[model samples]
Target: MKLSWSVEKNNQLKAHPDRGICFEDIVAAIDHGGLLDDVAHPNADRYPGQRVLVVFCNGYVYGVPYVQQDDGTLFLKTAFPSRLLKKRYMGGDDNGKKS
Candidate 1:
């Protein structure tokens, strides 16, 4: 399948080796979320089982989701590294903590 990386994702892949997640790692994580069927269905089964979550390449966990809407178009919702364990906590409830 063809994967699209955002401008920030491209930058992270270039300047900060530790700041960005690999294409392989992204595939692995997505596989765990059961979203791989769409890719592996017609392909050579490259990604078997993947999950769908936001992806953050700012050297953090809690994926910044790249969602494929019902219309079959793709989009990037979050462009920053995860500031908390989960994206839901990004509701500014950190009390000014830079985490």
Candidate 2:
């Protein structure tokens, strides 16, 4: 998948306080990290015309918000560290969900 970042996403990522994590980090994680799931953004008001791809990377869960164009280009909207842990991406018996 081809990846690109929007101007707003770049600015937001630069302003974020998450130490050692940059736009490159999010891109690398999404490229090599384990994918959790792809779902429509629950808060459509905040993430318009985008979906969220949850990924497990470096023992942390990162939510990558993006949109895929008709030409198969991925336009990354933004990314943030989710409160979930690595275990959430593992396996679950009760919920029967991997993530």
Candidate 3:
């Protein structure tokens, strides 16, 4: 399965590649559909869309794998390692603010 991580996530994993990706198994699930069943429901409609996925770096990490409608392509959108995982990974903030 094809998967990727962001530059920041790459650095974080570089520190400990062994334990860097506890959710590596998620990669397999990417192609098979919710193999890990860890992704939360979507809270908003935005770019990149929300889908269920198993993140390797940590529970804080959120990722989306998609099959391209153009040519039946499938790839990773880069694992996002952030506290944003709690909100379906659309990038927002506290105090009721959306970014």
Candidate 4:
């Protein structure tokens, strides 16, 4: 998976020395270990057509914010740890067993 980082993302990574989320982790998520969110965030007005990919790594859920460029490259806008795990991705009610 190829990802072009935004300036903010680079800065965020630099500012947070303890956070383990990195380029390699994002690549892994894109390739084989993540979920493509059906919901596109409306909050990111700066990034038009932004999409979110959620990945579970090291017991944490990372929401990777990105956009697909016209040239077909994925531009990674930013990422952060999510407070709640999305139900579908976690095999919750709609996807899993029903009581």
Candidate 5:
């Protein structure tokens, strides 16, 4: 899947200096066989064509929220470290075991 984000979005992500997570990291994690799911969100209507996905990278699981453009490009809305999602998807283990 193709992934993309706007310069303004990039700047917004960069604004959070404490986050230490970037678009590049998200892309790389997705490329590394990240798991995709159709989980429901309370604010799902806010983003048209939105998809909720999670990726495990560098021992961390990230929550990636995005919408797909007509050209099949994934326009990333935002990304953040999600320990709750990690535990839910990867099981409640530190070693990433299915359990």
Candidate 6:
């Protein structure tokens, strides 16, 4: 899938160097068959236009909120690491409970 993000958003993401993740990482993860799943944002009702997806890549999970353009490109609104998502989707025990 094609991916795109605004320059401003990119700048905002870059500001946090500690995150150790970039747009290229996201792309590579997707290219290499990273697991993708659609999820409802906590504020879904407030932002109804975009669909949020979580992806697992390189042992890390990211929350990617995006909109599919008419031309089929995914316009990524933002991306950030999500521990809650990783635990929920990456096949791990929840609070010591077996799956």
Candidate 5 displacement at residue 90 in angstroms: 2.1
Question: What is the Å distance of residue 75 in model 1 from its true position?
Answer: 3.8
Q: Pick the candidate with the highest TM-score.
A: 6
List, residue by residue over 22-92, the lDDT tens digit for candidate 5. Answer: 78877887777765454555376676567767777557777778777889887887777676777877666
Per-model TM values vs. the true structure: 0.36, 0.67, 0.32, 0.64, 0.74, 0.77
Tens-place lDDT per residue, model 1, 26-81, is: 54565555232222122224533333355422234434345464555454323324
Residue 14 of model 6: what lDDT?
73
- Per-candidate Cα lDDT values, in order, are 0.42, 0.67, 0.42, 0.63, 0.69, 0.74
**lDDT for each residue of candidate 4 in 5-57, tens digit (9 for 90 to 100):** 76666767657755556756666765675655635765767666888777765
Candidate 5, poorest ten consecutive residues by summed lDDT:
90-99
Candidate 1 regions exceeding 4 Å error are 1-3, 6-8, 34-52, 55-60, 65-71, 76-80, 86-99
RMSD over all Cα atoms, model 4: 6.5
Poorly placed runs, candidate 5 (over 4 Å): 36-42, 93-99
- What TM-score does prediction 1 earn? 0.36
Backbone collision tally, model 2 = 0
Q: For model 4, which pairs clash?
A: none
Residue runs of model 2 more than 4 Å from their true location after superposition: 11-15, 84-87, 90-99
- Pairs in steric clash, model 6: none
> After TM-score superposition, what is the CA distance of residue 64 in candidate 4 from its true location, in Å?
0.7
Across 1-99, the per-residue lDDT of candidate 3 in tens digits comes to 434445565455446533334234445434544433445335435544434454533333444433334343334443433345535443445323221
Evaluation by lDDT, superior candidate among 1 and 6: 6
lDDT by residue for model 2 (1-99), tens:
687887676776777667234567766777774677887887899868888878766556667778888889878776666654334565433222222
